[model samples]
Target: MMISHGFKSSKKDFSFGPWKVTTAKNHIMKSKDIERLTEDLNLRALPEMLFGDNILRIQHNDGFGIEFNAIDALKRINNSDDTLQVACAQQWQESRVVSEHTQEVVRPYDWTFTTDYRGTLIGEEMQMKVTETTERINLEKLRAREQIVFFDEVLLFEDELHDHGVSMISVKIRVMPTSFFTLLRFFLRVDGVLIRINDTRLYHESVPTSLFTDPNEIAQHLAFKLRLCEKLELPEQKQGAVNEDLK
Candidate 1:
């Protein structure tokens, strides 16, 4: 079965709108060793996969967006034995509200821009870039109001992955814009089954807006799928995945 993992943040039920946005720092561990992790995760070089090679482009609905290109920067890291550090950025529309006007005008009140870092032998880092752009009569005014906010950790990915016959991933995530809660997620892919786990902790939050999936439950489901796949004995195929949805 095919599965796509997307960004998830935990927040209070009452927290709403742009101000309620939360960032997360996750420890992403894949099922590859340090020497092979980059290749296995398709992050060996910068601009490797996901959303194509261009860093700046228009989205499906005519939304403008941009991301960092790390190809040249990563080449240096690959050539050197020393530790590497680099920053990547992305800006996109998080959500939008439709206007009552007859024309197709969308008033976007929430946008998310982030700067992220990935290293060969170190944990990942991320910073959310916030811009206060008002949707007024003059569109030019709204376009020029982009700015940077205080730097903070939003997402973290571990450089290494543990083995379990299949690729296993461990991730820790926290709410962004406003820190509300955190989540520890585990993922395992074997044959055609995908297993997911979410361990959550609430902080000053009344109700959880995210769903929690138990690791044990995932384990059982994974076990069943493995058996089923084995029984079916389908031929193995190799394929590549890109982050097209993000663009």
Candidate 2:
């Protein structure tokens, strides 16, 4: 999908299966912020592994980490196009139970989904498609289900401290083919605290009393947890120093 530089000011709400999700404020990451992260974390884009106009990647000292990229439908079939994709390495003591050393840590199984989204038939189909496409890229099958759901775009906010932990927050919008309604999914993860929140709310429709916790609130909580972790900040760079140097 084409990368959109504009920000949507209005808060949005929508549903995916049984869960309701609401859009929080757009988390904007300025070019300076990207530069700071790149310098502080020694990040590099894995262009050969994933394709996108914008990509930021970093790994933690314990081997768990994440990659954020501009969402693209063409790459979604392989589950490589999410705004933020996190991988918890098998060697990480906290993630050892779920890690599959034989397979790439970035695969679908590591993703934590909301109960409503995970239990639905559509959710199952989505997972199957990801697994199948990951194993064998089939453009045809991916496009066939274009009507069901298509990842459109996302905004990301992250805090990664090498020896401490990593916190990632994503606000992603998905399009549903059958209706004009767009689904807003808020995802948050804090490796140090072992906290994972994947909540969905609604948008473009009348607000309903949701039975689940508000996604925005969950995001705030995660942000708070992130703040409690040791901060990782690099000294201010000189005027023209190269920012692309990776350790």
Candidate 3:
């Protein structure tokens, strides 16, 4: 399915974006491996994609991090600013990897709806209501509805393993619109799980870096946004009532 994947601003910030690495040379390495190196170097991997040539990894220390990539200085002189282009490719590739991982993680479950309108007047009218997500996902039901799977609600999810402690599962869900006309009334789960309802305005909101940085945060942010969107997008009657109440 074609999606209007959003890119973090930066024509030059190519290290991470939407394209998946369809094919890569053997020299390519997994992001986790690079992250391991970052830890060994006592670095924190921030979003920045450093190095022009080769794969770029972000690194940092003291609670700060930056991006790093393979350095082939020669590639720089040979009309190949390998550092920049490689960073761009890595950025694009990593985005694809994360996007795919998120998709894989969220594909199995159905987004349960909620009935609670208290979250907001808008939500009361537009969103499905449910209490716990687990209550909503009927695996067998999902399998049966596979024909309309694309229209099924989508969620973005991620998990992280700490050096010491149990692994963490992060997740977020969005209501996907059935068509372009429904874009204003529905939302789609994003890689970050920052659900964007209505392609009009709220979709453009910038969330905290933490949401994109961690899957859990993404999930939490998504839930909060969903609640908020529900409150904001009131039906015609509710909107009129709210206006009358204000007057």
Candidate 4:
């Protein structure tokens, strides 16, 4: 479960039960590639540490798969001028190079690069249908100290925002003898503004007995949800007051 890593492009592949998984890493895009990305994504600016070619993939023998990559995640960003905003986000961006973040009154896009991208689902047979289900991820099982057969972490993108704070999205996957778990997180910390975090978790057993009934048939038990957390960077004097209110 050794993963080869380097500053440039590197990829690792592993087979776990009926699933095939791979992680790819590459250098951030250069000026030429940046222009292409901006045009293709219709985004005025992107993260400084944008690993556009990095990717994580998991495929099942039954024609089902999921993938996480910088391109797909960035595409999910809001394109409109009137998207998620913050009080000082625009000003902070304007302080940087005018080419990167314009000084215009309103930016053309959400410079924050907030995204709702869960991993992409792919297959020729599975049709996505929305339905209600009571299933939830087993936190206890995930927390257990199981022997990890394979594990790897890859960064999709990251930005320092002129060193104002960190805004990054990274994906980590772990495969045990029993199941595989994947976590993708988008973390943002606008200095003196607020902290926002978004997470996507995927978990499935490598060998499910129920699927043995039909050798060629496979079903993915997925849990999808939008969970967000935000905390205002209030003054120290207000902290006690706010905490008292929760009482």
Candidate 5:
């Protein structure tokens, strides 16, 4: 899934008429720390449930919003080298090119974008080894694997509305399944990197003002949704994942 953040502001036009309006645009990059934080998050474990934790925390900027699958796992890699393969899945969006040579751009998938901060080394060959920098490593692609933290449901608070807040959104993912490859006891390799994930729904959406009367209404609506979100459960196969905590 992909998330984009933008700030809204009003524009005044007296000639046409007086109206309350807003516009949003992509925020530009200003800090090198964004890159570091993105890398840390890529290697960091995903919470059991989506929307859990400050998953989108930035060093200097306030997170405007995040768009993720309210439906299913965006992608899954099944191969001999589960360790290396899974790490790539978390870091990069997959693409296919006719040649590994220069001057050929693979057609990008519309359903997804590359969340991977690092470039892909799917077709390359490398020796695998453990390193202190990462709890688990995807040396086949020369990268690190992440551990899975507890899955949680994220709730957005809105105070300007009613007693019943609106449910902003709901998201979840299989965290333990992600961290399983990190166990040093198991080592594996991959001949190529494969990405097979697509969002069934739009990755990003705009909240409608008509959904609630005021900020309080939005808050109450979200409160109700959060409670319902808590009922969500990962499948039985996705339970009890364990990994070494990051130092």
Candidate 6:
């Protein structure tokens, strides 16, 4: 169910024109979930806080929509042995040799958790022919103080990277009187090694005076389907992720 106005509930929801939006906020996954996910993902390790169940879902009346979730996001990380690693690659591997983590190092993977995922598309029509575009989201309109009607943020995953720095991904969304916006960000700081970021933005507006003017009609929608990656020289910095935490 989508709640466009009034008080926010345990879960966040809202609507825009023909679209219905919902989001879930959850704490780290339990050991059982972690074990299953690790085996399925074919990874040596996972983030300390992996909210594999949380997601940001937006759907249209016509069945076209998109979803952002941790499971799918993490799946995008390169598990191949040839994945490009960071500067402190050697240090990380050497450090692991001394720790119990060495047992899981069957192969090399992108420990950074870097992903090219934007969001998962739903419905047949929701997916149009893929094409390149230079269009960008309207930052000016998003900055408008239009009295946010709904807003929430949900974390996908986070890892302290052996206390080296931090790596995580979270999604935030807000709805205004005239439109709604969403941002999915992945941040990484490997300390003294590198700082990286990946972002995905989605925006849609209501235009009552548009060509097909309807009070509840959507005017324009700009989809950010590209993953932005930035790696910087970090001047710095888990285990089975101890069995604990449930929400």
Which is the leading candidate under TM-score?
4
RMSD (Cα, Å) of candidate 1? 29.0
Off by over 4 Å in 3: 1-138, 148-162, 172-247
lDDT rank, highest first?
A: 4, 6, 2, 1, 5, 3
Candidate 2, residues 1-247, lDDT tens digits: the string is: 1223455444444544434334334435455654454345333221111112333222223333233343321122223323334444323324222245544333332233212231111221222122222233233433454454434334443333223343333334444432223323334343644655555332222123452278863442232333354778999967875668678
Off by over 4 Å in 4: 1-6, 82-87, 95-108, 124-132, 208-247
lDDT of each: 0.26, 0.34, 0.24, 0.79, 0.25, 0.73
Per-model clash counts, in order, read 12, 11, 29, 0, 27, 8
Give a tens-digit lDDT track for model 3, residues 47-106: 222222232111112222221123221111222122222222333334333254364321
Candidate 1 at 89: error in angstroms? 30
Error of 4 at 61 (Å): 1.7
TM-score of 2: 0.24
Query: Of 5 and 6, which scores higher on TM-score?
Result: 6
lDDT tens digits, residue span 197-234, model 1: 33322222222233226554344223233333335667
lDDT score, residue 95, model 4? Answer: 61
**Which residue runs does candidate 1 get wrong by more than 4 Å?**
1-25, 31-35, 39-61, 68-78, 81-152, 155-247
List model 5 lDDT by residue over 76-140, tens digit each: 21211223323333223233333467544332232122122211111123322323452323344
Cα lDDT tens digits, model 4, 90-189, are: 6655664545455454354777778888978877887344456787878887888889989999998887765667778989999987789999999887
**lDDT score for residue 30 of model 6:** 90
Query: Best to worst by TM-score, what's the order?
Result: 4, 6, 2, 1, 5, 3
Question: Lowest summed-lDDT stretch of 10 residues in model 3?
Answer: 108-117
Flag the better candidate by TM-score, 1 or 4: 4
Q: How accurate is candidate 2 locally (lDDT)?
A: 0.34
What are the models' TM-scores? 0.18, 0.24, 0.16, 0.74, 0.17, 0.71
